[model samples]
Target: MAEPQDRAQEREELEEIVRSIGRPDAFVLHEVIRRTGNEELRRHGGALFLSAFAAGLSIALSLIVPGVLKRYLPAADWAEVLVRMGYAVGFLVVVLGRQQLFTENTITPVLPLLHDRTLKAAWRLARLWAIVLAGNILATAAIAAVIAHSGAFPPEIQRAFAEISHQTIAFGFWATVVKAVFAGWIIALMVWILPATGAAATFVILLMTWLVALLGLAHVVAGSVEAFYLVLTGEASLHDYLWRFFLPTLLGNVFGGVALVAALNFGQVAPEVEEKKDADGTG
Candidate 1:
């Protein structure tokens, strides 16, 4: 009993020491981005594009994963639950790799921009959007073509891919865009929450993303999987994809992630920082 109390006291002292080191200031996030914006933009711009493209390619597995599981366990109703775990694999790869993903940028970098609000900031955001979207599409097209030609994935999986392709066509333009907006918001929230979660960030990100996928939220990169499937099958033209899915989803994602989450996050923290500076000045 005495040993247990001593151990508890020691643990409390260690925790207090850790706390005395202090949590990161909210402004630190903004400052890091502000200080490193140029180098970060240059390095991450290409990286984001490549990562977004990779994400597009990887996300296609989501559609096929369930089908593959079903093919093996056709009679098992609970198998659907197991396949959902596969959806997190791509997100884990992209995020942990520290690659630039458009969905994440919608919130992360924008917080600093919103706090500062400069012309250069606007230009950076524009450049990032253009590069990421173009890269993602190119990646999706390349991957889809490879999958269609490779004969690697089973035929049933290919057929299921085709089925998902047809469903995107049915959603028309506006609805797909609208759904993508919601997905962007959720993804941005995941990014916002990640910095605070520390070691558990992976699990938090996976849970949030899985929830987004399970809820039928549309993501620009993820949706590219289905869009490319149609393109590969020669059932849908790239023109339709550009006009219907790509443009609308792109705009919607930017609006949802940047305008909503990033802006709001900055709004919440900026005033407090300003007040503290004012107090310091007065003192």
Candidate 2:
């Protein structure tokens, strides 16, 4: 039998365990934002481009899996569910691999830019964005070209790709833009939440990206692969890809990532940051 003192200690320990399950403090999350922003600003153009290119290639798996699944599975609602779940794979790889995904840029570097608000910082942000977006598109286009003519993918899988691309384009220009905004917003939020999640970081990535897919939200990089697949297969024109999907989605993602997530989050933490600055100066 435990003594009363031992029972009280056990109760206290249980309370601490429960408390430990809560979210990270604002300061810790702010540090994560600052560190990630600084790191993105610091990466060289060549390295950033290579990582973005790899991310673009990896994101193709999201499209490819849906095709493969549609080829193998019986037609049903569950098939759609499984297909949507597949969308999470590429994001998991990119986020975990620490690749320079463009949508991710909408938030990460922006934080530091917000913190500094310098002309040089803005230029650096723009330069990084241009390099990463160009690399991602170039890589995805190359992959789409190879996939279109490689004779590696089966006829059924190719058919599935066409069907998927058609559905993607069917959403129309403005709709794609709106959906892409949500996609960007969610992805940026994932970056913000990850440091606080600790060991469950991967699960958060999977869930957030899965929500992006399941909701039919367009993601600029992954959607570029879809658009390029259509172009390479001769189903879509370059003009269509550029005007209909790419430009709108890109702008929407930038708006969502920068405005919806980073700016709002900065507003919430600005006071805390100012307080710390004053404290440091006084100390």
Best by TM-score: 2
Candidate 2 lDDT, 1-283, residue by residue in tens? 5665665675565445434646767655765667567767777789999999999999888888888888888899988898888888888888899888999999989987877778998999999999999999998898888778899899999998888877557677898889889989999999888877867889999899989988988888998888899998999899889878898899889999999999998888888877876888831
Worst 10 residues of 1 by lDDT: 31-40
TM-score of 1: 0.78
**Candidate 2: RMSD over Cα atoms?**
9.5
Residue pairs in clash, model 2: none
- Scored by lDDT, model 1 comes in at 0.68
Candidate 2 TM-score to native = 0.89
Candidate 1, superposed: residue stretches over 4 Å from native: 1-39, 42-52, 75-77, 275-283
